[model samples]
Each structure stands twice: as structure tokens, then as C-alpha cells.
Target: MRLRSCLAALALVLLGGAAHAAEECPAKSTSMDDIIAVLNAAPGCDRAMKLFEACEYGASGDVQFGEIVEKKCEADFLGHLKPPQKLSYQRELRVCDRKYRNKSGTIYISFTAFCRAEVAQRYSRRALKAGGAGR
Candidate 1:
């Protein structure tokens, strides 16, 4: 009887903790500006962006390309965008893939250099014209 009660108490504690964690996760905000703001505010944005860029290059057609590289890039980007504690990585990756499916090479290049000022300055102009900046 004592063991049964202990197990039930432990289960309740675990469920309560999960509920608290879910409440702490930020709701997905609308708009690119808001999304960017959230990303910029995060601690590992720069590192995550760098990892994403490196993985992206490996995944590109110009490299020794394969689905594996692409998958790695997608996973890394989603992982960095919102850590596991805050977001569902698989769900986020699916949404990201859908949004980026028809993007041009130039826009892809812009994202690859998102952390660099000069590259962004050069590409932002073209991206603006291509309707890649924001909708």
C-alpha cells in the first residue's frame, strides 16, 4: 500500500513539472520581426546561426550533397532556433521546410550570411527586390 501511494505521488509530481514546463514555453509569435527579435534575444543565436550556415553549405547542391546533409541542416537550424525545452523540434522543422521550399539560391545565400553585416547589406537589397525580405 505504501509503495503504491509513493508511485502515485511521484507520477503526480512528474506530470505537474511537465505542465509547468509547457506553460513556460513561449508561444510562437506572428511576423518576421517578432521571430527575429525572439531569436536575437536567445543566448546561442550566433553559435546556432553559425552551425546552420555550415550545415547549409554542406547541404547545398554545390557540395557533395545528399539528403543526410539537408536533414542535418534542418535539424541543426531547428535546434538552434528554439531549444528542445522550449519547442518541438520536429514540428518546427516541418513548418520551416514548408516555408522555405520554393526559396531562391540568392535568398538561401542571404540566410547563410545572416550573422555578417556586410553580406547582409549586399544581399538585403537583392532579397528585398526578390520579395525574400518579408511578406
Candidate 2:
């Protein structure tokens, strides 16, 4: 429940920079794959959200797990960007959370998941296009 709300808030905040990403590489109609599984064996988003919420609120010793997922997300997202665009995307990624400025720990964690889903879907759609570039 908490993670769900946090994710919603995170999306509104992330919309600012993610909006740029959307403008740069909009998602297309295609088979979407979830990419927030930096954990590889994360099962699904519901479990992942539970992990994030537990990690954030200290209900479990999952802080290290969350950090690893976060780093992986950044790394994976960076892989999709061209050299010239990388800097701008990174800036947008960083600026997203800061601009919205939410105090809830759940918000931050859910934002990570939301952004991951967007990035994954964007890349998936791009791959589905004629030449691996979004239409």
C-alpha cells in the first residue's frame, strides 16, 4: 500500500525529466517487458515493491539490495543512451527526484521502479520498430 502511493507520487515528480525522455524517445505500441528486475530474480513488481518498502522503512535488511538495484537501473538506462545524450539523460534522471522533492522513503523507492518500467518499455518499443529506433 505504502509503496503503491509512493510510486504514484514518484511518477508525478519524475514526469518532469521523464517527460524529456518521453519526448526524446517516446514509447510505441509493442510488447512491453518490465525492466525493474535489476535483481534478476525479483519475481515481479509486487514482490519488488515489497522489498523496496521493507528496505526503505528498515523492516528488513534490504538496504544493500535496494542500492544494488538502483545502481543497476542507472547502468542499464545509461546503456540505452548514445554518448551525446547520456549526459542529458543522467541530468534528467537526477533532476527528476530533486525537482519534485518528496519526503517519503516509499516515494523514492517507487520512483525507481516507475522509471525502470518506463525505461524498459521505451527500449522494448524501440526494438520493435523497423530499425531499432522509435517511430
Candidate 3:
């Protein structure tokens, strides 16, 4: 029951972010920091999260963007959580990693990164929105 409500909250955040993402997605870039910088500006990385999402699906150079975004996004997301939340997130992230652990090279890494970043962003938006209330 609690998990279901959390999932619902996550969905609301992602759906809200998607609309903003569409309008604010940046041009393709070679610099990972460039993308991360933009992502950092968004509480949920909503604007630049699209870039990471699209880049994950891209071949070659695009995968680099996803790799960079995911690492920083994951770190950024975890930075905002408490000790207990971090432990729970690590467990959740392990599940996320397992879902893509089979693929070789950057593809699997980037895919799992995307999955983690997506969840991180959702938590960020919802947590910030509620001012840490009712958690």
C-alpha cells in the first residue's frame, strides 16, 4: 500500500516533468558536463532529462551523454536523501541494475543509468514538492 502510493507520486512527477522536458530539451552535445549542468538546474532534471533519455537510445556518441548524465544525476539524487532513504534507494538501484546487467559495454550501463535517473528525478520532484511532508 505504501509502495503503491509512492509509485503513484513518482508517476505524477514524471508526467509533469515530461511536458517541461519536451519544451526545454537541448541540442545534441558532446560535452557531458554541459548536459549535467543543465540537468542540475532542474530540481527533477526535467528540462535536460530528455537529453539523457534520448541519448540513451542513441548510438556511439550519444551513449556518452547518457553515461555522464546518469552518474551525476544518481549522485545528485542520493545527495538529497537521508541515511535510511539512501539505504532503501541503494536496494532499489540494485534492482534497477539487475534489469539491465546482462547487456555488454556502455549500452547496459547507460540503460541502467537511465532507469536510476528516472527514478531519482521522480523522487526529487515529489520530495521537494511536499517539502518533505508525509514521507
Best TM-score goes to which candidate?
3
Our tally of clashes for model 1 stands at: 0
lDDT of 2 at 92: 54
Instruction: Work out how many backbone clashes candidate 3 has.
Output: 0
TM-score (C-alpha, index-matched) for candidate 2: 0.34
lDDT of 3: 0.61
Candidate 1 Cα deviation (angstroms), residue 88 = 25
Candidate 3 stretches with Cα past 4 Å from truth are 1-25, 28-44, 57-80, 132-135
State the TM-score for model 3: 0.53
- The stretch of ten residues in a row with the least summed lDDT in candidate 1 is 58-67
What ranking emerges by lDDT with the best candidate at the front? 3, 2, 1
Please identify which of the two predictions, 2 or 3, would achieve the higher TM-score against the true structure.
3
Per-residue accuracy of model 1 over 1-135 as CA lDDT, tens digit each = 999999999999999987665422131543334434433433432333333333333223312222222332343233334355225544443454455457776455343333232222223333344554331
Candidate 3, residues 1-135, lDDT tens digits: the string is 999999999999999998676543463464656655555554434544665664344434444554454554554455778899889877776787799667777666666766666666666556556565321
The 10 consecutive residues of candidate 3 with the worst lDDT sum are: 54-63
Query: Which residue ranges in model 1 land beyond 4 Å of their true spot?
Result: 22-33, 45-135
lDDT values of the candidates?
Answer: 0.39, 0.45, 0.61
For each candidate, give its TM-score against the true structure. Answer: 0.26, 0.34, 0.53
- Which residue pairs show backbone clashes in model 1? none
Show pairs that collide, candidate 2. none
Model 2 residue-pair collision total: 0
